[model samples]
Target: MRRALPLPLGLLAALGTPLPSLAAPSVELGQVLITDEAQDELIDAGERLRETPGASNLVDMQRVGQGRVASNQDVLAYQPGVFAQSAGNDGIKLSIRGSGINRAPGAHGSGVYTMFDGLPLTGPGGTPYELFEPLWLSRAELLRGANGFDQGSLALGGAINYVTHTGYDAAPLQVRYEAGSRGYQRRHVSSGQVLGNLDYYVALTDAEYDGYQKHSSGSAKGFAANVGYRFNPNLETRFYLRYRETENELAGRLTKAQIKHHPRAANAAYLARDDSRPQPGSTWVGNKTTFFLDDDSRLEAGLVYHDFPMDLREGPMRLKVAYTDVSGTLNYLRRDTLFGHQSKTTLGWRTTKHLPNSGASQFVRNGDEFGPRSRDFSYQGSDTVLHAGNDLELAPDLWLTTGLAMIYTRRESAVSYPADGGKVSLHDWDYAPRLGLRYDIAPQLQVYGNLSRSVEPPHPWSLIWSSTVATQPIELENQTATTLELGARGDSVLGRWDLAWYYAQVRHELLAVEIVAGLPAKEANASPTVHQGIEAGLDSTLWERPGNGKLSLRQAYTFSDFHYRDDDRFGDNRLPGIPMHYYQGELRYDWPSGFYAGVNTQIASKVQVDYANSYHADAYALLGARLGWDSPKQDWQTWLDLRNLTDKRYAATVTPGYDDAGQDVARSTPGEGFAAYLGVSYSLR
Candidate 1:
């Protein structure tokens, strides 16, 4: 924290303040104010992100904690161009710009690169959900679409970086407890401190719940820690560690009628077999080192190790999957003067690969009893990319940006248990290039445009599971797209607003369809497709009184139009998972005494349930309210959250089938009904 000394009488007199009494001249000084390191860091991060010529969002976890911070779904609310919904467990369906929209929620999710504290968390297989405890985060940054090029993420959905709290932003000791309907409970304890040039932070958390649907309970426990040291003004390093384990029971999907009448009933098959997914454990360890070459240049290097193993007991089979990945990254950043103009340049290299022992085993199951082994398979994959980018100031208040990247990808999958097991191995090279420009129309307004390309590789494990024959592996090509985007963001009379429009010409687009009720879906390369969307967000201070309170409104809306350009069978049919229109808004009133109340709503259009558009999941609107109080000294907090106030029964998520023929298939997960929760926390600073 920084400070300023009290004003001297002489300085006040020089500033033309009149003295009331010469014998006893009095001076009145206001209370000392200290800035929160975390808040300053968030502002600096947002300013840095605004330099990019694309859309992005910075999420403050502290604000999100006022209500409920259950999962990523809660953490990512009110973010335009992003769709995240829970699948009745830790698994959530997350998509950006129609990426990975159809696949069912599972142990691993795709189409985006995820990170924790700037270290790799997404690898060749995909992103795991076990270690994402929302309370461990200080903030989150989302780079949508190709805006993540600087982070070495070459995916359709770009990247998400979760930043954890450090000693500078944490209290010395803190404890929290939460309880609510359906027997939900959670507890947490954490501590952080700074000593000389060294700092450390650690936290422990656990949660359990009796879910809304029968046989859908779940529990989790986790810990996160980090330590950092500054050797000198020019050198620094930090180490990070995270470990978590979770077990959740499964309730199979239900038909439209079932959700309307018996929303809390589990599917008969799921109840009979007691289906569940229990993650044995997940761990991530990493270190990052930085070298300040000079005032205008720097270099950073990082290495990470990740291990996530799963013990899945669902459907008619039990699968034990072992996944481990290792990654390395290096980046160089510098500024220079070229042709008498200011310029900034960056060069980076990164790679991620699966370990030798990454594989899975399957066994037959009946009524919670295991049978003989059925199949054994191993997955192998690696990704390497070298990229360079530059931004040049062509004129005052104007910038030109350009970048290119070369990528190498390898995938291999083999069935090793059965005799003469089939195998598939493929390697390919691809490239992406980008160009963009931005100009400051005024200090409070700016306009930007970018033309870029994106490439996404199929997961190695998908090759084995997507096959028609049980013992064979299939080969598929990489998905690629060329996109054009135009956008602007700035302050206006109404409030802070952002609006963007983008269109992509996708080639060999990857699509997944459910072939069976309880098995991995089949992924195939589509002929061609078109993806277009509009994203808008606004935050306004509706009313304010200096000594009383303030009223504010925040809103986000997305309009998506994604479809097959020309297919022999589907014929320009719309995608089946995401809705065409989505919106979320919150109207809140905050009092100067640390009390606040808010009402929020979420609305979405009908969603198609099949590729043929034979049927749909009906549109729905949800209403909720939150009331909370934060102590003036920031030592304590308490809140009450009410959800689904009208007790509306609707499908919260959908897993599309190939062709239901207009039948209301068992393909939707019911949303939670009316519920209430209470939480409180105390901190000793």
Candidate 2:
């Protein structure tokens, strides 16, 4: 038996060292300690997400807005244990602590859940790609692992919620534009207003990019709006609307040799077929109502409807899909004193109904010409979940947290093609339980630990499209895991730091593997596996003065150890895809005069490409820098961002595959070369 390593106390001690006190109060500290009405009104919307007893992070858009905000990578760069690699302007491969590490580009069963505000972005079919714009968000909250139980997440990777700006928190008027290398350009306009008892916010954005690789161009246009009515101080309701249309050319992947010699070239096969995503779009509307039962209690309910249409042209196939989803949630929260200690309890229920219509056609060599129909399918799926949680202050400095979630899912599908008429159905019931404890060592320090279980049902689409059973059956077992985690987070005189260590034993873990060189990856259940990792983040103030400004260093490091457990064939080989070590760091300086400059770098270790652990992607490091100015009036801001300063040629992401007798395959997407972006924004209160 392999013994687990002990937590790194020395590393934590080093990061917890004390530093000189600032002459002025730190906004960071104020965020944690201040609870006055004025301070509460000024708090970022994501603050509540950070109060979880497990690993969680809040990204304030104000900080990220200083640089290029192009893709998910830009928004999640400083977060530990999570990796979002850009495959193209509109494609990002996301993984968290080995979750979804085996999935290929465009695949969506990653166990990670995504949301917009409180609305589910990952529908019942489990797809959340090419659906978001960073500029539209006010902040984002990442709750790792079972910490996301509050959001009805049933995945090992947890959930991320993107919170948008509201009339009360947004600028009265704003305009922003960005232009960058590779024909990148974006423009956005927004307005917010409040009248008597009503408030409204609206935004429109258009973006275009001719990617670094050939045939990788993409464009998008989006509109988002929301209106709120304050029935009274105790009750309020808001309605939201969102629409987006996107189109992109697919570049496909390349082999090691090709990546080294012609990294900017698109796959020959993809180019021949003119592979692309044509006018993929979505429309969504939703409403949320909240009622304050009392000072310590509240009730909230919300409902959302989404209509999505997508078209894709692969080498010789064209697939079109129409998806509709209706989802809703009801939640209640209460706080009371239990045995003289503070206590809080929450109850929530969520449900979603998904309807999807899909069809595929075979195409000839003639571009945009289709031959005979290949497959057609219609699917109906529904998921209902009930969850309850409680937090009890066991003592003056100790708290206990517990939660339970029960989920029921059902899927029914009908297929028609080649005279093969059939119907398939699958149903599953799953439960997740979590227990955690947290101790406050000081006003600014905390340590927490949790033991939890997670369960993820296969996506409805995966059950029909990626089945690997000999009979091609649609029934698949749920992916389940039991995890144990320990962590510490605090702000010291030196800086703010968050560190965590976790180990998980997983059964029926979902695996995506490419059996053929040119076909899409297929999904299957793998043997038992082990996932363990260390996630650490630090923000240190190296220098500070009230009038002179400040110099700060931010760093995030993730160490992942994931492998099959004595598998029948692979025999404990490392799972392919994610690197064992990844690190990102930045040194930034800000002046009282509203000027700021920062240099950042990212480094990753070599990653295994095949289950045999024989083929691998070479390690690479990227450096970048940004300089910006913010007017004291907070009305105008501008910045220049430089990326890939060294112009390193490397794979930004890779698709997992089985061993092919030691031969390398074309399954890697090359990283972008040196590029620069300039952005300017103006806002009025």
Candidate 3:
């Protein structure tokens, strides 16, 4: 028999409390609000987020922009349970909660779902990399595990939503410029304005870098814009458009010996072929509408269309793909009093259709001529999801939340090359369930626990491609896991802290194995495995003097313990690619005059690099510092950032291998050395 818990009243009290009086009337983008209902809606939305019963975090982009803003790693450095490593200027590898931990370099599959302003960035085929720019976002929301049910995401890694600034949140005019080491330069310009019921915002950016490693360089250009109209205080609609073009050279990986002696050298094979990502680009358009039904209910609908073109050269292979994606979502949220207690319910539906017009793979013997057509195909994929969840108050301070999701996916492809006519189609149906309880111990403290199931299907590329050994196709079974989690968050005299512990039993876990040196890894289902970890974060003010200055400390730590569970082959062997211990911290001092300085460090324990558990990468620690001045009037700001101050030589990331008994191959990408950057920004309102 099973029993359900009641919803907690602490969240309702916290959100319903009256706010303090403001010092002055707020004016945004020189526009005076015509009604107070809009402001109330915003506040209600924020309160609802705070009431969630699981691990969730909101990152303020303004705080992240205070230092180096060049890469995603810089932006997500303080996020617990998230690991982001830079492969180059335009490429980044990201994983959360052991999700996609064994993915190969440049692979098109990810277990984590990513979105921007309520629009899906990951297509139905699960290929999502390269769609983030911190400069264009106002905030980021991270929902871990089952906490993302409201977003209709069933991935083990959970979901991330990047929210962009609107016309009301932007300045009338803004300009920014940055110059850094290795011939790096960036420039951005933006403008926002409002006329009658219409509002609009636009931004343009250009960047170039002579990368840290030899033969590694890149350039990118982007444009983003949004236009909106307010039909009434209860209804509004917005349209978004974005375009970007990028070209980058590959430096490739290096051996441990080479990393130690000549860390900046490019791989010989990569240099021979001049491997590069040439003219990779995308265009996106989306529309979102929201309707507020009374004070207790709201509905949202959105649609997005994306066009992507990719061209790449890797060693002796040339690949080209023309990809298009269409997605739509509908969500309804309602809050009411159930049996004289507060109750909330959410229902969401999402669908995505992906089409690849022509995907071609060719072998090239010379510089400009294609040698042989290895593969050519056209594909269509679709994904549909329905999710519903409810939170009901059972007692004064306790709450119970339950949710379920049903997912259906299909893939169809026709092969036109290889002189053999063939057709392939696959379909799958999966269900995910979640249950959780929350209790409020105090006004500022809370504790929660949850149990959930997650499912992930194989990407189309993985299903169609072949393993390096060529013994069989690379089509893998869907990965599934059952997880249990407990967490606590609070603010006290000591500081603000958020901590969580989770354990998962995974079946048919996807594992990538490097069978051939200097080639893409092969995907396969591994034996039963266990993933457990601890995520902790703390932010505290050590000392403060009224009207003088203050000192603060911020820290985040992650402990990952992933291994096989009494397996037949590699019995209890630890999984590869992730370090057992990873930590990041910062100490800063600020003055009343708007001057601040901070020192930050990152540390990682030795990591296993192969499934055999016989080979490991040495541990490393890096230190960096930054000093900046921010005007109190928010008119001007400048920063000087210094990274890798000690110029340490270490691997930024390592690829996983099956066994390293007699293999001596390069499998690591070297970290950057000492570098400096200076950035300046000015805005007019």
lDDT of 2 by residue, 144-262 (tens): 88788989887899998887777766778999999999999999999887787998889999999999899999999999999999999999999988888888898888888888889
- Model 2 deviation from native, Cα RMSD in Å: 3.3
Q: Residue 403 deviation, candidate 2, in Å?
A: 1.2
Clashing residue pairs in candidate 2 (N, C-alpha, C atoms within 3 angstroms): 19-493
**TM-score for model 1?**
0.94
Report RMSD for candidate 1: 9.4
* lDDT tens per residue, model 3, 358-423: 344545545445577576766577888899999988898888999999999876655566644455
TM-score attained by model 3: 0.92
The runs of at least 3 residues in candidate 2 whose Cα sits more than 4 Å from the true structure, single-residue gaps closed, are 1-11, 15-47, 356-366, 468-473
lDDT tens digits, residues 443-486, model 1? 66767899999998898988987899888899999999999999
- Measured with C-alpha atoms, the lDDT of residue 455 in candidate 1 is 91
Alpha-carbon error at 109 in model 3, in Å?
Answer: 5.0
CA lDDT, candidate 3, residue 139: 63
What lDDT does the true structure give each of the candidates? 0.84, 0.80, 0.76
**Order by TM-score, highest first:** 1, 2, 3
Candidate 2 local lDDT, residue 530? 97
Off by over 4 Å in 3: 1-46, 356-358, 363-369, 467-474, 662-664
